[model samples]
Target chain A: MDKTQQSHLLIEDLSVARGERILLGGISLRLSSGQIAEVTGPNGVGKSTLLRAIAGFFPVRSGRMSWVESEAADSAPLAERLHYIGHLDGLKSALTARENLEIGLRFLGRDRRTPLQALDRMELAHVLDLPVGYLSAGQRRRVALARLLIVDRPLWLLDEPLTALDRHACALLKAIVAGHLGSGGLTLAATHEPLGLPGTIQVRLGTR
Target chain B: MTRILLVIFVRDLMLARRIGGGGILGLVFFLSLVTVVPFAIGPDLRLLSRIGPAILWIAALLASLLGLDRLFQADQEDGSLDQMFLSPAPLELIVLVKCMAHWFVTGLPLVMLSPLFGLMLDLDGPALRSVAATLLVGTPTFTLLGAIGAALTVTLRRGGLLLSILVVPLAVPVLIFGVSAAQSATISFLTPFLVLCALGLASIALAPIAAAAALRTAGE
Candidate 1:
């Protein structure tokens, strides 16, 4: 894997809409390597929308979102450089956890670890063979978290990453985010609870 | 790119097989449709042989639409569609690969079983081979067309009926050529069969692009 190089996302006056009704507007933020942007807002405020728009899931109404890398000017499309964990886990419950992660790893490219090792990292090595449907919500969340470890990407877009986690799983996630940030990776998460990590930049939606 | 497409293909295939009902549902639907037909048409052997290919083609076409509404709906609801859009592979190719895998799971079986159903229709050996061959080439077109419908309606609560409606009209050309080619076992089969092939090839090349665009429109 290439050594962690400097990368940053620059968003200016980013406004996103759903159909006619505008969900959020006039949002400006800059996230650089090693910084976490925790988007907070009232329910229905579109914290998820901003992160998703940044992930290239929706068309921005009006704004300039640019990516700057120290290594190259025109880097790969933003999709390949990021990992998006949305409101729903992008997993096939019919497949085992190992199969799920392996499919993600194979599809996402840049395999950093085997599926077993990633699950082991998430304390889910034992449930690797179980169908994801049988796992509890917390276990399923961790299995989804294992996705981050298997594929190496610089940007992590997490939506409600802490929903079903026990205190222990939260700690695991915190440590994982710390490691990712330490390696100069950036995270933009939409969550109600604070990530409990130092120096996390907060962006609130549905305000102003 | 190939790796990503291959995994998607394999994953979809595995899901289709493990889900246990898609293939069987399509087969059972095709069988029931055929079984119910002779009751209406009566057991006139000559009449049945003449119209056997059309009956089989219509049944297969409807059955191909059976499991298609779930094609993108499952992925959409599970959030896999968003992740898929985020993949480096082009969405059009991914859509194509998905439809191809879906056909492998659902459409091919109907083709494989057409001969037995043809026998029930009292079709001769040449007609049996023609039905199977035409269906083998023709079913993928149905799936490709249905995929476009599936992607367009991925977000609706109950899109199955709408999916069939949207797909069947567009599928008329495929149905026409497929039935014609299958019925031409005695006459020069090459003409209609070539048209069927062209229609299939054209849909294969174009349906994915339209489906991918629809998914993008309905995605967010």
Candidate 2:
């Protein structure tokens, strides 16, 4: 795409490493608004690392990851524009599902009502008052996904979001991603299995 | 906001209660140490009284260090620490909130229960008051300094012992002033109290940055 047509996320010749170990080297990709980029790779091919780098959670050892909000070309701070979810679901186990959602909302500085509605949409109302430690793995995963529903950021970076989730939860998450894309929000998700998301653009790493 | 701090403070206290024994174990250890000193000295009440303030301060210092290992370990293991780091609020704010919560659960309680230890150590009324006041100012410094050590060791396999080693030396200045203030309160309180408050304020300004840097190092 031409520069004018690329007012979105661009990862150009990016390289990252941890000490002497190179996590990813000379990788590049671009993601436009309203598009979902599904990153597929082997287990240790630095998929989560890539997502984290894009979200500014980790530094790019070399090269650049740029975000253009509008006409401006320089990249903004990654945290300012993206919502990132790593392998470890970030939920307070001692807190009830509702309280966990509330904390997530406060973190995003979004409305609590929206998070409550998200919990309802996920069909988690029955256990909203139960501490997350009491919930099953699938339920915990759903609570994490509920964060995606309530947060209003334009970009989502999720790693292995479907892990441990049941068919219903998986389908629910896919639908949420689809809705997010339809609303001009972008997504960069890394996963081992194909998510069966319709019209997603796939970026295969490790092999190429 | 104070409300946010209060919520975090209460939550941590509840967790400390449910976990049971870690927070109180330190106080119990402090009590025993204070009581055992008289036995070791062979009925020297004069010496005990003279050294009582310092003894109480040292005991409080060690007791505060008791649960330092768990400051960020549980949160890191559970992924809540990562969430806090990523929250829209600045990471420094999160560090402050977490440290304040920790102080409430561990340090504040020790300060509250310190008078009994003072009495056992034959600390006079003025000395006991000094011990309490110094702890009120000093333990927060202890908590803040311990945060850096906790953050640095949070990801290590052998974290607890290493954290204590790293932090106790850094906390030496605070302990010095803490005990000094308590010991001198019988005759001259103002100078030591001012010095202790200065140490606390300096720590309040610097420790958060150090802790944040340590956390970033651990993350890398």
Candidate 3:
């Protein structure tokens, strides 16, 4: 992955609401270059909601979410600058894994690796030509994660990235995230299990 | 920028060619609708020819709406819609490209085959040609209009029926102009035809914007 130097993410006193109710509130966090924030919380604690909120999928009632790239703030919109891996795997079942990743690479407008190389990194190159529907649940999840490798984005918002992954794939994900962070990329993952990477920031929400 | 839009367009066309996603359903449904009309009118060649333009317009309108119901919903269900939101390409352009591919598969074929459907309904040479020509300019309006309905009802289960209900009423003007233009093959061919073209252009400009707005809210 290409190095993303001097990128930073800061969320201050963020409050996200749904309809008439506030799902979570009073949250604050900062992530500079080469760091990972593991958002851990009990179920229904708005873990996924926070990730979605940052990705601009969920509504934020109050907060100043800003990004600074290369010593200059007010860079690209966070939606275009970040990657969000939600629960749905985000792959079209009719298309092969290679096609899905290629579309992602083009649409994301940033390229780090070819679909072949990205899948191989997750030990999933053999399934490259297979339709995503044919892949098992774990394989599909790994293919979805390969999307992260194809794009060179500064921030990653992952919701339960470890789900359905076997031990090997889980380790693969951790190494991928670690490599990403080492390259000066920032990541925020909502996970039940530990990412087990060093210096992982724990942002627990919904305490109130 | 063109490359990104082309990628989305190609992916959608590929899906629509696949088994369950194929546009053959729309074509076949169109053929069936045309086929049943002759029988319903009891072999009255004069009546069939007289009403052939209306039948073709209505059938094409319904057929084009077939593939649109899943235009955004399938992407939403698979999580690709979120990735789309994150893309540098504008969402309205994305919606337009997807709808273009959709119309290519579902709408274009119907336009090409409508002359044959017209022949089956005892239409004359001029009527057949005019029907095909008008559909080329008109079917896209159905796809564009249906896109709004599709995006509005995307998160709802069984939105296909609701999509029809919502879009059909709105498609009346296009239908009226389309049928009139086709039926006017022997008369002033330019008037209603131009109006139909204007409707197509207007929908092409505006539907994507409206559909994209609806999709933005549906993301939550």
Candidate 4:
């Protein structure tokens, strides 16, 4: 392992377990800025669990994980550089789409203009003020992804980011992933099928 | 940090006001409880005077607990709780802001309304004033102490009942001093009022840290 290389995330022999059940065993991976990595695996093979471990959602059973930025091991808290979008959209049902985006940006220590642009990019300008509960499933997925545009973090851990999205939304997401990679922002996305992402490395964990 | 706390507090307080019907319902419940007591105990003016303060304080505590149950429910569901944990704001400051906001809406209003309820209970002017004064100072302590229980039981599905079970025990001292302060107006009034104030100050200082730690452990 090249410990001195500038990697955004370094996971060494990381093992995850739920009680006695081993979800991932002796997994090692490194993520560097300006790259995109996709985790593809069968159901219950711990793609989501691996992402969670990298984001520090839980402690690794017998190994270690470290996050770095600019060749320096970043010791800032989770919010400073990591943006995690889990299975749920994390939107408020009662609030309008715009309000949800604004609140999310505030929580991430950013402003509103970028989120609005992201919503516009997703063709959601018309429904900006509509309560998210009224939006279609694909629209809700876009709203969740718009979070990626609002904050300028260098690392993204997306779990099923394309779930419930349509063909157009999927294409848009592909372009967004490309842009993230071009900006030197590392992304680790979990998906079941081909995302058409440019030069993405696949890590198939089950029995690999 | 204060801004973040204010945002959390204001957002939840406004939502509770608009959606949960906490403001109106809490007052109505307190009113009914106070109004029904005279009928149950019979209109013995002396007995009403003797027990009125205790009854009012108890009703207010119980009524406020209704809204307190929902304090963290929305945040827990919407991933906001996790985000708050990730925030730089000390968990204790966040918990304190939430408890203060709860008091402002639920307990503070009850303080202002106590005098009106006292009048219905045939309380004298000085005793009614005493009740208002004591509640004004004591309700924050009640809220802060109750918040510890709220934070502890937030993860439980049927938490309101459990919150009462946990909180009612800790709130005993506040209830004692609050009612006593109101009742003692007929004698001297100064001693219990000062004691209530002291209890409020102590709770203001201590309860936030306790509630924050309890909430983090419960969430874990």
iRMS per model in Å: 1.1, 2.4, 1.1, 2.7
The candidate that wins on TM-score is 1
Give a tens-digit lDDT track for model 3, residues B1-220. Answer: 8999999998887787774544788899999999998888896789889998999888888788877778888888888899899988899999999889888988888988898888898889988999999999998888998999999999987998999899999899999898899998999888999999999999999999999999988866
Worst 10 residues of 4 chain A by lDDT: A1-10
lDDT of 1 by residue, B90-120 (tens): 9999999999898998998899899999998
Which residue segments of model 1 deviate by more than 4 Å? A1-4
Q: What is the lDDT of residue B213 in candidate 2?
A: 77
Model 1, residue A43: C-alpha shift (Å): 0.5
Ranking by DockQ: 3, 1, 2, 4
Q: What lDDT is reached at residue B144 by model 4? A: 87
Model 2's CAPRI class is acceptable
Give lDDT: candidate 4, residue B98: 80
List the candidate numbers ranked by TM-score, top first: 1, 3, 2, 4
Fraction of true A-B contacts recovered by candidate 1: 0.71
**DockQ (model 2, Cα):** 0.44
Candidate 3 residue pairs in clash (backbone atoms < 3 Å): none
Q: Model 4: what is its DockQ?
A: 0.33
True contacts kept of each: 0.71, 0.35, 0.86, 0.11
Give the lDDT of residue B30 in candidate 4.
96
Q: What is the lDDT of residue B156 in candidate 1?
A: 96
For all predicted structures, in order, the TM-scores are 0.97, 0.92, 0.96, 0.87
Question: Model 1: clashing residue pairs?
Answer: none
Q: State the TM-score for model 2.
A: 0.92
Q: How would you encode candidate 4's per-residue C-alpha lDDT over B1-220 as one tens digit per residue?
A: 6667767676666556546577778889999999899999996999988898899889988887877777766666666666566555777888888877877788888988899999988889998999899888877887888888888877777898989998888888888888888888878788878888888899889988888777766533
